[model samples]
Target: MFSAAAALLAGAAAQPAGAEEETGSGHAVVRPVSGVSPLPADCGEPPIDGYVLNPNAEVLPTVATDPNRPWHLVTVYQQDRWNRYGSNGAVTAVSDDYGKTWRQSDNLPPFSRCNGGTAANGGDYEVTTDNWVTITPSGAAIAASLSLSRTGETTAILVSRSGDGGRTWDAPATLARDDNAQFFNDRPVVTADPYHPGVVYAVWDRVDATDAGWTQPVYLAKSTDDGRTWTTSKVYDFPDNSGVIGTQLVPLADGTLLIGMHHETDTTAATQVIRSTDGGATWSQPTLNVPAPFAVGVRIPDPDNSGDPIRNASLPLLAARPGTGVVSAVWQSQAADGTFHIDYAQSKDAGLTWSSPVRIDKTPVGSAAVPVVAASPNGTVAVTYYDFRNNTADPATLPTDVWAVTCKSNCTQPASWREQHIEGPFDARKVPLTSAGRLVGDYSGLVSVGRSAFTAVYGVATGDSANPVDIHSAIFTG
Candidate 1:
């Protein structure tokens, strides 16, 4: 049943005009971009700025295999200087073989280097870059939303595409054309519904960052014509947007749109949901707010509400119904052991309601990174995250790896989580993915942690290893 469901979900998860074929090994094979075929880039030993070329770094592995080219697998990410930093600018790369060979799309769609130095209105924005990547259903189309900012400006959003698998692109068109001074950025999740893959949804937090204070609201837009044309702005009801953390979107089985939002608030805060039965035009008012542990009385807040060194620290995930409409949410609870305890909540009824939170990560690992929710048709649950509950790994720190645990069906989580070391040849571990072994880290860059069939994705730190990040991506399936 699970295998059968997976087949159907494969169809449902199709991006609108998605990626096409090519070949390589390990999940992907690297090669020269079509136009630059004979000219292999010198990624170098330490890699150069805007060209460090981790060729190993991978982000948001939107994986697909070309039907005609049974030997090739395709993956995509924002190329940049090695270190994972900077959302202000981004580039795209692809791998043909499973996860072995790779290539960066140098021939971009006539884009102006607006942010890096082209800050016409450019200014310093988040060091993070792109997180979400989507390809058309037929794998013929590709779209990526990048974070941007102008001189003395807040962060902005940009979208670019290519007809030939990340090859040459149309000069990236400014998706956030109305950037009057809003710092709307982070977590750009883009995907096309399977039924009508042509219809694309670009959802992100639209923030108003004026000196007075920052008011961030989650906004979503739909492109019926594959982004060539987009629907007018509509603010999806996610009051949690006050500082709405990552809002994960999943196209449900019954044509209903399900959204799982994680929150920063404590008592009154709980992951909430809103749905679009009629596409995205209308969304239900905020669902019953499911307060965090503090409010439930099961968990107590820090007496002082002390600030965690990591603000925007919490990461939540939604188990999207790849081909069906089953939605489940998972996250590390505030009452967590810091080492790596993860909890899960499900909304079988399509976001209308949720089950009580359950501790899904039972392994009691030393520490936990972020959690990812990848749903199979029969609801086979694949939850992956990092184990740092006890201590984190660093090239200078220690050996850290990406970990994952699986369940037989939806909601049937394991009693204890198991660890899988996913430190690519590079060994940078972060942003654990639910889809496979994917991780999101540094440049907002994403890649696979270690070398395993299960693909891991994360960013590489370049400058200062803390600032001006770029994005990278790759895939492996163990």
Candidate 2:
């Protein structure tokens, strides 16, 4: 017999068709994808950070679409958050008819007990974090995550493949694992090569601790046979006490690869990039792209929280125009007055040189977090993020909204951009409160659907503890 949670999850496979809510300017249409069902209470692990499980919350979503079949869309997210670190397990939702409806899949390779994990299957971890999904040119869907024990006993990177458009999944293949106390892996990203048929790359940071301090080095694992197997290598390492995190891989149309990361020292943090010409064989030394004014991995505090804050970061999002070699990056940076703003920079010559960073968020007040960027075939760039500009003087409630900005050409100039309100003005304080803070997610999803329209999959709060957060999608035209 299936558990009550499992039975409910099975019944939630086919979500109802969402009603179209067009923006006032008719530039975008928003749809509800995941519906209002509460997530399953699947993980039996005890909470470590004094916070109870928030089973109604769903956070940290990543999305992708099959190029050969534009109607095939896949989104992976963390469900039933603990308000501290990870989730009960990750959930995969597939939409074959564009964004109209979705089918939630239960085959995610069991990263925890919630997903039928066991020590025999190498999924004995207590919780999972950082869910990412991508579709290859041949319609194969790949999902990746950071699976680890809550007590810091083990940490690993795992990838799973789906051959039938995400209706089901095969057992996940472990890409890298660390059993000792000295190494911890975090912030993994998986990308299928757009030009190469069966090649996919996963990049992350493995942090090592010594008597001096902590040092994190970038690691790369390449799978040439569509994630069946992987060959791992250490691509870059910093000196002791210095490291990097949030590594992102962007494969150009001409077969060149660019990896962008947040390089950090004890007192400084900067956005940096590295290039690989002959695939993953060798890489150039890192080049400093933008020196950040604030720390990279620090979580933002909730304005309404008197005790615990919300868990959010300012990780950089990178994108490259198909054939023009024009690469753009967007991230949240804190100003001198302690306000966070979304910033954008461009690189015309691949990942070598970058233009000066410009403020992209049009909000004159409040802070922004979790910026995501995507590029269309015609070189148009779009960036999406959430801001607190709608919040009033009420400390009991925090009103938040999602906004998107797009630019066609001359993107370096501040005036060349157009801003549109995608969704929200919801109560941000209604999310799960964790040791890290109240949680929406560390990142959201935004991808180009065609030449001008982009689809974003993101989370929002509903002010109801019984159903706190829900995943929504917005398709907007530049």
Candidate 3:
């Protein structure tokens, strides 16, 4: 179920409990997940759906810091089956050089199966989506969670932890132990407080029935000790369908927590959430922060086509920190010329508010979809957009590149976005300062060598398929 590198990483280190390989600012001592030197046959599965979400895939890479070894970068990924029949779990990789090489976690479930079920043709139903990863200061542990596929009608809140680097992990535990699950959950995100490395917070969509398979309302939960246990979750009841949704966590240098999400109905949606002085223990009412556009589309499976005219998708919270919680987010909208444009936004307040929505590109035009973001130590925010700016003319043409934009203090350069397709096969992006002012995007997300370079991991594309995405990384200087 793992690639050669992942199996090797697990075998390479028989670390003592609480041991960690050092680097900088709590990053994993990562080796590239798949190297250009020639992929090992056992590296891992190939890309799927012409997209990153494989039946058993790892996406949404995140870095966490360790207090004692503040140099190790431990990254975590949300793993499900390569097709759609696989269940939920996490796949982990670590970096020693700052976001480069990757090794899959051994002992740990390659996939976090909060709910067990047989995989039919690698397709499983009712599993987790959008997992958030974080690390503890002592370099003693790692934590994260997702919307677990519990029993009937229950999109349960699930959390998991790892001790001694990323080699092995503990079983996933639930966030809300009580019996008040009124709504279904989507996207579970976590952020460890800078001041209190032991403190962690998670925010997610708490809906009446996201069973419709879209987005809905939101709620939050907090943990005072790593991710061992969680407090009861509280739904942030909003005023109608136009409520708070798309929950993400951003912790400040002083332990303050900022939660960002989208606040709008079908016609008035915008990117926004809230901030908590006492962690997720309490939160203010929904705050109307950043402006982002959310569009709806449909996909009908076809046996004779290379593409769907309307492929619907949305981005969850990327990465966050203080003064720069939101770097980028994506949604679809129509340009003045009546073409669909993928719009993005960055937030500085950990989602308390956000910059205006910037249109990256429009349809010929088709549009961009599933955008994500990361914060750079140098104060730059890196954004990754899966672009299809030329798809209107050729349905067989897959997105040629995953592009990036580096911005500081809410960059709103609409005209600057005109220069598109600066990168490749990447689905994710992150800014690692030790590597320099580089902007990294991914077919996958990983970087290990350039302490001063931004790195990305992505999967290689061999042909056009519905699952055309996988994990790979590259480094760049912003």
Candidate 4:
């Protein structure tokens, strides 16, 4: 029954305009522009002047562009350098000139026990992180994030909407709130319903402090009146409290939603999902793939610090074609020689079945991590990721680059893709580390604009006197 539902939804989504054949011959070209960060010099945070915003880190940028106005783009992200449980707030950036430049805004929504902020807008609760933004066909923008109160005793899922192209926003409405004294809420994502304008969806996993220990339950919510109000449902209950990360929600043209997430246990990691056909009202049983050998480790150049690795591991990334049910997924895996590389697979029949996994990145010398994939209106599939391939310096200092590949046509064919450089050659060490000790946040973003274009935003260490990690945007065309 689930397979039938997936196939039906896949068929409902419109396929790309042309045949599934190669179109261009050259490489996937990305033009760089002078984009701006969402936060100002002081990030609107009064007390801290040049001290924080000047050399601070803005990471995990998620973008949403207007369908009619291709040049109008809206993005949201977390503020402050990596502070683990304590983050400044959420900030927004708007671009009207095809991403040539950006304007900052304090449009983040608020949550329980806290009145929304303005003088220094951003952040939900007193400490917030894991922000996501998306746009409706009417060009309205919606933002969501996980936030905690000043005392960190409560956590809530907060959302806000921007009708004026992100220049201004409405007060946030809360979807879920809990004491959070023993549980934690993290990594929540939002998606706009393409078929039904003004309707949007949000999903995240909830950890509960059960008497046995802990258990993870997935939750879903929907807002039909453009985020003014919301209704939430408990989607599924995992057998154990395994950690779920890198969750991607894909809304089909037929009103069905597909969720792709990486579920991790103590010994192994796997890609899993729970589908909702009636706007997240109910969900099918969780479908999981075979477990892959996985371990978290960071490579350091200093021999003395080599054994002490940071929290790092491969998490699944997913993308779905605009009109078609064709979906592509990628993650990182280590080969026999101990080299980490990016792997790819696709599902022609929605999430029912996927092709055999194929290694996609060029010969891996250093390592490739945090892969993000997106599909163009022309049926072109693009994958963006960070790698140390160009790092000639000591591995401890970690110099990396942002690279992308285009599958002109037959994306399922491993050899049908061409590689192109987007941005980078910056020192990763300069970027602040999360409580997890990982740089560049857990994931970045890559979004397709129109028939022939796409955009990606990532964090890069400027290595200037301040040594801050700033946000950079690149527009790519074949």
Candidate 5:
């Protein structure tokens, strides 16, 4: 069920007792499950009514949780069965028992007209991608996604908010709409203000602003009334029509906000951080912390990678340390051996500077991609990723398994972290192909539920035709 590369990774490593590996920090335990748990069937199915089904994939899932009410969690993603460019529609899942159980609902807030009709039915492009969700201190849960018209001609950013603990959402709000059909919006992120309950910020990359080429112009939208009204404008513009991606937002404790993204210009790639003092109204020049370009994509040797393209490539994720301005960022990096692994760095002074990057994944062979990091209230840093290391058969077809690492504190040192096996070995081959390639997802979701426990949501193959790709939730209590 795996591609050629994944089977090879599993074959390279031996499955020690319980798949546990002893690291410098602690014992890394690979907990076994009876295959992946099923997500709500109603929520996992896409509404691909009229369009011809391509390699319909349920990918790019993200999650948000209530800090005050750890039991309340929400996740949103795309159900793209028709085409890779457009999803059937955006789907939402809600969990009230701290991710133990989930329910699917398309009761999204009402949407505005984009090109022809409502944003959902805008054009032939008919897909939604890169959706994100956040819960404010006031219990208002908000979500954002990028909508493209038929044939992927035009793009727009849409938003929905819920005031009743994510049970019911208000009308959808249009944060940013492309004036020119040639322009595109990618990977919009939503973040709630840490200091203010009603304040929220949404940021995304807009391409082709000045010239015909795609330029990376970061746009910001602020909602002061908990998603009632909005002000949208460009916050930072890169020199030339240079390219950038991976938009990340984090609201600091002192009323300021920090945005992180990967900036690519010419032949070089680097990590960039820009800050705003007065909300999202203005920003400073991006500070280049890491000099190396984010790895393009990993090669999973055995499977015919020709058709399977990684959904979201070379995107950086950020997590703020508890009780301090220090923040840690993780992204996929190609090692000297030509294998992809997770890399980490931290900025102690509120995104001003970063430490040297260090590799986190312990797999000696194969590739690891799509990493997400989260910091607990007690300063425990947890990182989750999927790798092919567990598929040990000689001509391995077993799929990728989810792995995690945790550090009590001072996680910057690679030796201080302990790796743990979460779940996997499902048939990655069962996941259908998209225009972007075989899609497990662009990214997975991880959130700190309590002081020591963490809840994660990720996509895995169910080996069934009804739903080729399914999203499952797991909890890590170490």
Candidate 6:
């Protein structure tokens, strides 16, 4: 089933084009894009309710475009998501026409049974999560995910390479793995070096238990020869009772690697960054970027589902401006009224010194969640997030909308940013309900297409039980 569906969706065949509309913010156009890779009915093992669960759902998309070829875009997302956990596997979709169309890839290294995983191939995990993709300077595309067993016995970080655009992928290379439940790995993010052609990096958190308490060490894997093989090491480890997650690598043009992470202790939480000047050999102590007021890590109470909470997070997203040392970060922060707002901050000296955080979400009445940031070559910084401003009072339905804000100059100024509607007013309540809550995704994808444009890939609800959520793409131009 997986092979057949992959073959069907693997080419230049176009998915339905969404309506085109112009935004009031003077943006050129807002074009919605959809993928053709819907999960098959039988996507292999770990069946749910006597059949594959959420067969038509796709979520947690990550998009990257080639620098040499801007029109060549690739997005990796989870397909056939389960209610409580991960999807059947991670899949890739390639768009050569600047996201006007896409080709879905079926060869993702078989991280789960749905994609042909087996115990002998080191991909026998029951599910796969945290799908991330990056394009190296040499035009090689790399996809990474956290594959784990159903019984929590094994967790591994695996990456696959696409020498072509993203049309096909090679078998995965395991960067790091843990067979014991005591040491679990989570939230793996892969990054390709913008300055080096064949150098790639993968970072994640390894949660370990000890006599003192729980500790999470940030692990780094370097593949100098593209994504063929990797050397893993512990770059930074939090103290006892403290751990870090959502680690993202921001490689600068000057050979410095900056890792942005969400650090949490028993009583405190903050967003921090660790720098590696001489590659991944050693990392400096973390420098605090922003302090999280609330410990709200990912899951929030769903107004519609009392038993389930929305899988949202305030995870910091850091992006470096192309050909510049300036880096910007964005994350959602909870307010006194229990509503979440998008916050923005910038670092001029490569994550060493950060400006004060500023609220960026324009909608005053509702909460915002899952913010993603990107910086263009022309020094324009943009962010995309979902908000509940359009939601009604009805408990049975939660109307949500996607929005994007672009800053041309000083992003630190609240008035310098202009907000534009990307897509939405779709009922989030109609999406698949998971144990974590209504499923959208932990994060979305926003990548700069050129000097004044960006392509955002996000998840939306379809209101159909057979296909509740879909991965969507939108092109925004200034």
- Which predicted model would earn the best TM-score? 2
Error of 5 at 164 (Å): 1.3
Per-residue lDDT of candidate 4, residues 271-358 (tens digit)? 6655678777677765537465664343322212443232364467677777667778887776665556778888776566778788
Worst 10 residues of 5 by lDDT: 15-24
Can you list the residue pairs that collide in candidate 6?
298-312
- Candidate 6 achieves a global lDDT of 0.77
Angstrom error of the Cα, residue 444, model 1: value is 8.3
What TM-score should be assigned to candidate 3?
0.68
Per-residue lDDT, model 1, residue 474, is 35
Writing each residue's lDDT as its tens digit, candidate 5 over 251-364 gives: 877665788888876567877778878777778776545765443443334333344444436478888865578787888777665566788887778777778889888775
How does model 3 fare in lDDT?
0.47
Q: Where's the lowest-lDDT run of ten residues in candidate 6?
A: 15-24
- TM-score of model 6 relative to the true fold? 0.90
**Which window of 10 residues has the lowest lDDT sum in candidate 1?**
295-304
Off by over 4 Å in 5: 1-57, 109-125, 209-212, 294-314, 392-398
Candidate 2, poorest ten consecutive residues by summed lDDT:
15-24
TM-score of each: 0.67, 0.91, 0.68, 0.83, 0.83, 0.90
Each model's C-alpha lDDT?
Answer: 0.45, 0.77, 0.47, 0.65, 0.67, 0.77
Candidate 3 residue-wise lDDT, 1-478, digit = tens = 2443343334453322122223334232223452121212233334444323233334445555443332345665544332232225445566543444455555542223332322421112244445456666645445544443333244556666776656676666666422345555555666666567667677776656343433365666667776677775565665555565556776766455666665666577555556677655567764545454443322212112453332333434545433334434444455454344456665555555666676755323444544555555555555555554433333443434555554544455665542333344332112111111111211124221222234544433323233332455544433
Residue-wise C-alpha lDDT for candidate 2, range 157-220, written one tens digit per residue? 9888887656677777788999887999988899998788889999999989877799999899
After superposition, which runs of candidate 1 have C-alpha atoms over 4 Å from their true positions? 1-88, 109-128, 150-152, 177-183, 209-214, 237-243, 264-268, 286-289, 293-314, 336-340, 362-365, 389-396, 416-419, 424-454, 459-478
